[model samples]
Target: MADTTGPISTLPGAHHSVPAGVMCDDHPDRPATHRVQGETDSFGCELIDMCDECHGEWKAYRDTPQGGVCDWCGKHADKLRPRRDYEEGMYGRVYDVCVPCITRANQEAEEELERSGWYD
Candidate 1:
């Protein structure tokens, strides 16, 4: 697991504190207490900020399952799809992925290809 000691500052040109009047992306009314930066399964490699509630939601998404932790969604479950030469853009890597994450990634990739007129 990565060092989650404090609010990660991976956002470009972002300050340490949440700006005034900013609300949580998950909850529209609640004030954002924490700024979270992490990876998403289908959203490609990047960091995003979240409120405390959303942070909790993200943590739940990354919870370990019975088999092991998923490299994509970070969830743990009974079944995981293992890949030996998973091409992660700039590098070829090996990791175990949860079913839902794999499904979502496939769907997202198909959508992108369709949008590019390559999946027809």
Candidate 2:
């Protein structure tokens, strides 16, 4: 079993939250970090933000009718289905990629961390 003691974790871990919008799949040595939707096994499936990666490695959400970040390259996600489902007062889900803007962003972050010697 996983640790579950937070107020949010009061509910089932699988149904707690799933943030919406941009997310990072993360780079090696540095865990993933992004505001992303959840993984799914079917279309219009519910997604949630996983913390294993600060973001997290996508749980091999393969063949899911719902598309997400490229399992490779982590780029070009326009092919992903847009978020069109919303329930009042319900938690939201997010997709990892939607633009090529992350390369620069990641690079900048890496440099900043490197300068600070936090690249270990």
Candidate 3:
């Protein structure tokens, strides 16, 4: 299996994109500033356009008492890294997730694919 233990930016694959002038699906009142990427979807991907306040709240919510942490695990880290590829898709970018979490997520994704007979 390919290395699933690297930053999301290091992983090669397509990301999500939405239409322009789209409002935050979560908050229709606010203009979408962040494109939140979720699992891969059939009709494009599960992309969400989030407002700045929502995005900031999301980051704060994902953070630990010590400092910012991985998007997956809540473990505290000195610094978080962004997935550049996913980030550059539209405007909103991938949250600063940690390497370990990225690796684990990739591993889980690979395992899921294997279970689903994606390789077979």
Candidate 4:
């Protein structure tokens, strides 16, 4: 679980917070009043500032039927993730990709890391 206890601190491992009136990270038109923590299965332990409406929308998206054709493999997937590649601080086009393709990509990255002998 995420630790959301205490005042805002810049210390290491501290949970950062954005006060109200700040623009919602997902929705520019909305004002953020809450912070959403990242989960293990989803993303890193980063805190995202969101408004109540945006939060509800996020929940609705998660509750939606996870059925879509993967753009990477052109195959039907039970769960398609919105994947994007970042280069030079800019994000590329987002692709609805299958879990299997993501797993394969991770495996390839791991193999490449091992071959590079960075851990040795």
Against the true structure, what is every candidate's RMSD? 13.5, 15.6, 13.0, 9.9
* Candidate 1, superposed: residue stretches over 4 Å from native: 1-66, 84-91
Give candidate 1's whole-model lDDT. 0.54
lDDT digits (tens) for residues 1-120 of candidate 1: 111223222322222455566676667777766554443232322334467767777678656443878887777778775442224442233357788887877787788889999856
TM-score of 2: 0.25
Error of 2 at 8 (Å): 8.8
lDDT of 4 by residue, 49-72 (tens): 677887777678767868789988
**Against the hidden reference, what TM-scores do the models get?**
0.39, 0.25, 0.36, 0.54
lDDT, each prediction: 0.54, 0.38, 0.55, 0.60
Cα lDDT tens digits for candidate 3, 12-90: 1232344567787668877776665543322233455668887788668556443476665778877665543332443
Looking at model 2, residue 27 earns an lDDT score of 34
Pairs of residues at least 3 apart in sequence or in different chains that clash in candidate 4: none
Best by lDDT: 4
Give the C-alpha lDDT of model 3. 0.55
Q: Report the CA-based lDDT of candidate 2 relative to the real structure.
A: 0.38
Quote the positional error of residue 107 for candidate 3 in Å: 14
